[model samples]
Target: MSDIIVFGIDFTSAPSARKPIRVAAGVRQGAVTRLNGLMALPSLDAFSDWLAQPGPWVAGFDLPFGLPRELVEHLGWPTDYAALMAHYAALSRAEIRDLFAAFCDARPAGGKFAHRACDGPAGASPSMKWVNPPVAWMLHAGVPRLIAAGVHLASLLPGDESRVALEAYPGLLARELIARRSYKSDTKAAQTPERLIARKDIVDALEQGRTRLGLRLKLSHAQRDELVADASGDSLDAVLAMLQAAWAASRPRYGWPDAVDPLEGWIASA
Candidate 1:
């Protein structure tokens, strides 16, 4: 009877029909129940619509929320969320590439950009950083939808207790299970039998409730097969994030407050 709905999002900016957003749902019993198979959402609009539906829900988004404080402050960008979103959205991908390249040009050869303290501890790349993954654009594309849907960010303490959003890093959970075994194969060519076995191992552990976080992943047989079959871990990543959100949801003290430093930002595990 817990009214909280849990969603785990596997996000992408250029998602297509074949690899749309993957979402997993869980409901609270004494422990969490993995209600059904993961759902594939076509776009942010569809995601927003789903979020706006009746019922209190908490979502674990697999994208970064804010940029590193150092980068934002150094670049003299607007710090407010609304202004930041506008500034971010207005820039084209090419512009972003150029700006980031220029920023790197100003730094020492080895050190390109300043990183937040949390980045090292949480093992997350800086949102504004463009090198390994363009996480900044990921934040740009993803956070607005959460805002539009009126979800409360766990990092930004909201007045409403019903709807909650938490920034979740799927890597943290994946590392716990596999210890750097490369369980998720993003490239289709890299998908192998061993990777599939790793996915199954992780899935089995979750279904059996084998984490210190105190929640069990409930999935139907078909759901289990789908999750294991996804060598890319897109679906599995969403499910991992969902569990992180569920763990945060169980702890009321972890609610996000408004004073978060946009530059330093916040990390889910940190």
Candidate 2:
């Protein structure tokens, strides 16, 4: 395997050893990418420490790296990507909630969010949402760590060349393989056989190289079984993100569009 590594992060804001950030790590070898390991960062602090380590690696993190441009401009936060993140990093979560709530209240009912161009295609949640996926919190909890670690966030900002971060959304890939099909649930009571079958279908398609990105997933028998058995789909999402990381590694500009807004970064494989 090459010294260069790849990672996919399934993040949690309130992390612990019991429910830490799930990471899928792997290496790309020619046409096949082998998923070599799965691990966790027990807390956000632990996650930060890991990012600070020196390495030549590319990672696809399942979190929004920026906010809506309109929102930023409206709030008069820094328009520069790095400056905006710095400003965002300094805010308390409660302050974020209050500010974003007022912004939404000023907008029409059906159009509460100011979206980046990629969101519609990527089918991602608004980075400002505080509930459900809580991606705003994901941005709050995750991006600052990336910035603090001094890693290059591909199109967003330049930092360490070896340690590159790209935003990834596994749901984008999963939906391509199985449209609008629910594959996994965080709640044990909600994990159904239908989702299980959908997960299997997605796995089968990836192995067959059926997706547009055109990279085959290589997994051991046990790894395959373990991914398939996770009712929460966290493991599967990590793998999907790993595949996106693999794709990003193989492309120019990390597969981002040529004209992405600097303040509103692009999502990998969106």
Candidate 3:
């Protein structure tokens, strides 16, 4: 059997005191084993510590690593990976807000930012965009750590096959199965019993490997209950993202390739 550890990462937009990063792990033996607990790391440093643990592992992180090539060219930001990370990290939220605001201010109300071609295909939020989801900053906050961790980015085409990283969008998988139904809810107030049931329904389907994608989730009963209990879905979301990562890891060709085109994106469907 291949030794594999999968990490599912649920990313944050503006990581505040309330919402930190949530990560879940799934170990694969002859079968998949969903670990008992999830890890909630407070800061990037803590996350780095977790990543540095001794092991060959694959991670599915739910954040954009690259922006649209068009957006980068228009902004005239450094295209090199190292330079881009530095440039992005140096800017504060306020600065990012101002820049995006200016861009929006200049454009007509209908079209604020120029979206990449991949955006339609991938159903991805614009990497240069800064509003609603603030995915650009999610990339800003999330990607640097992956780079620092030295994991093999699917897009980078790195030679090291042990430490694999893939760009996973859990919503894509969720929408495929559930369609328009709301299966997972992150809002505290919206987390009613009905939503909890929905989460369970989704989990049951995943365990049974009922989707078009032929992957089964091996989870313990206790783990399932815990996943459904957490209204925030920090753990469940991470697991979903991790599963996507695992799916990507299994396939070399589909792994996010290093390319510039924000328009090329994927999204979850109902």
| Clash totals for all candidate models | 9, 0, 18
Tens-digit lDDT track of model 1 for 1-270: 464567788887656687788888877576865655578888767777777766577778888877666676777888776577668778887888787778889989878866766677667776766645767777767777777667666544342457777788888877777778878767888998889998998989888888767778888888899888888889899999888877777675443334556434565545
Q: After superposition, how far is residue 124 of candidate 1 from its true place, in Å?
A: 1.5
In terms of TM-score, which candidate is stronger, 1 or 2? 2
Residue 18 miss distance in model 1 (angstroms)? 1.6
In the range 130-219, model 3's lDDT, one tens digit per residue, is: 766678888777777777777666544353457776676776676666765676565767888877777787788889887655668888
**251: Cα error in model 2, Å:** 0.9
* Candidate 1 segments exceeding 4 Å error: 1-3, 157-161, 255-264
Whichever of 2 and 3 has more TM-score, that candidate is: 2
Tens-digit lDDT string for candidate 2 (1-270): 343478888888888876778899998876677899998888999999889877688899989999999899999988999889899999999999999999999999999988888899899988888888788988998999999889998878899998999999999999999999999987888899999999899999998889998888888889888888998888889889888988888788888888888888888888
TM-score of model 2 (CA atoms):
0.96
Ranking by TM-score: 2, 1, 3
Error (Å) of candidate 3 at residue 134 is 2.6
Highest TM-score against the true fold, candidate = 2
* Model 2 whole-model lDDT (C-alpha atoms): 0.88
